[model samples]
Target: MAFSADELRVLRRALAVALHPAPLHDEDVQDALLLAASVDEAVREAGRLRAFLLADLARYREALPGSLSGYLELLRDALAAGYDPQADDLAALRALRRNPAASELLARCRILAERSVRARLARVSQATATSAPTGPRARLFALPGGRAADDEPKPNPPAPAERPVPKPSEVFPPRRRPVPPPPPEERAAG
Candidate 1:
């Protein structure tokens, strides 16, 4: 219904060729076809762009809510474009309740969000219960500098079997300090 000036001109020329019995320039026909192809390409690109925008908006909405992001605007666009809300989308809409239409969406998403949570909890419990011992389960000592000690490869256990195990006395000899006797309680310095 909405034709650009160039499109209208092309259409007029075509109509002229159709109505008036004359050989219109072959280049003009090709030009009109090319313009139509370009228009179709533009439309396809716009659709792809919209899809990308919608996907990004959903991702951002699902992420932890932070400072004023363009979530609401994206949501508005998505809703106008008839995007189905996911659990995260519902949660986001719930948080951003200024829009009246959000109430309906929130209600619809409540069950979805609950199911999502239950599924997550179920997965966590399953993992905890069924996880096989991954390389000796023990209370591992953490390393200095906040790194996990176990994560680092252990210094290749002294390759030779004759790794001289140092005796306790040799490794950590006792320290004998002379303890000075305390002065007689302030020597009755009444």
Candidate 2:
């Protein structure tokens, strides 16, 4: 959101007062409160506008071929306004792919959808990385007779004795002896 020069001045003064903890003039306090309220109102208005656009887009999509042009136009506007394409939008565009405009929009929407998915994955991975436990975890189950599994130091298993590995010929012998070829086809005769 672009802040007007007057709003910027008010915001600067408010930040300075906040950081410095100085007594502010009544006028400055009122200006800061008004600016904050305006910002909140602007946010609410944008949300309402986005909701209306989505509802209109849905209506246009439902009207199908008859509203193809309007739907495409609204969809383009929605995309430009940072709306992520929904499954319904993708499906509708796929069904109307015969139209060049719909085809182009479909490609654009697919790219946007992929980007949205990647961004969500990145966010999820970031959250998981940040929130995952870094220390040793407690055991879920205990041994019988009130003994915890990790209470005692267990002895390591004994290693097997070293042995020679058998060659393939020793493991899998030939099933039968090789038969000699006929002596030169019986000197080229049957």
> Tens digit of lDDT per residue, candidate 2, span 1-190?
8999999999999989888998889999899999999999999999999999999999999999899999999999999999999999999999999999999999999999999999999999999999999999978974564666457677676668656799999999869988888898796996
lDDT of each: 0.71, 0.94
What would you estimate as the lDDT of candidate 1? 0.71
- In angstroms, how far off is 37's CA in candidate 2? 1.0
What are the per-residue Cα lDDT tens digits for candidate 1 across 1-190? Answer: 2678888888788788889968768888797798778779888988998889887786767663552246656765775665555656776777866655566556655655577678889999999988867686788775575667657676665667667789999999999797786678865653
- Lowest lDDT 10-mer window, candidate 2? 141-150
Q: What global local distance difference test value does model 2 have?
A: 0.94
Candidate 2: residue pairs that collide: none
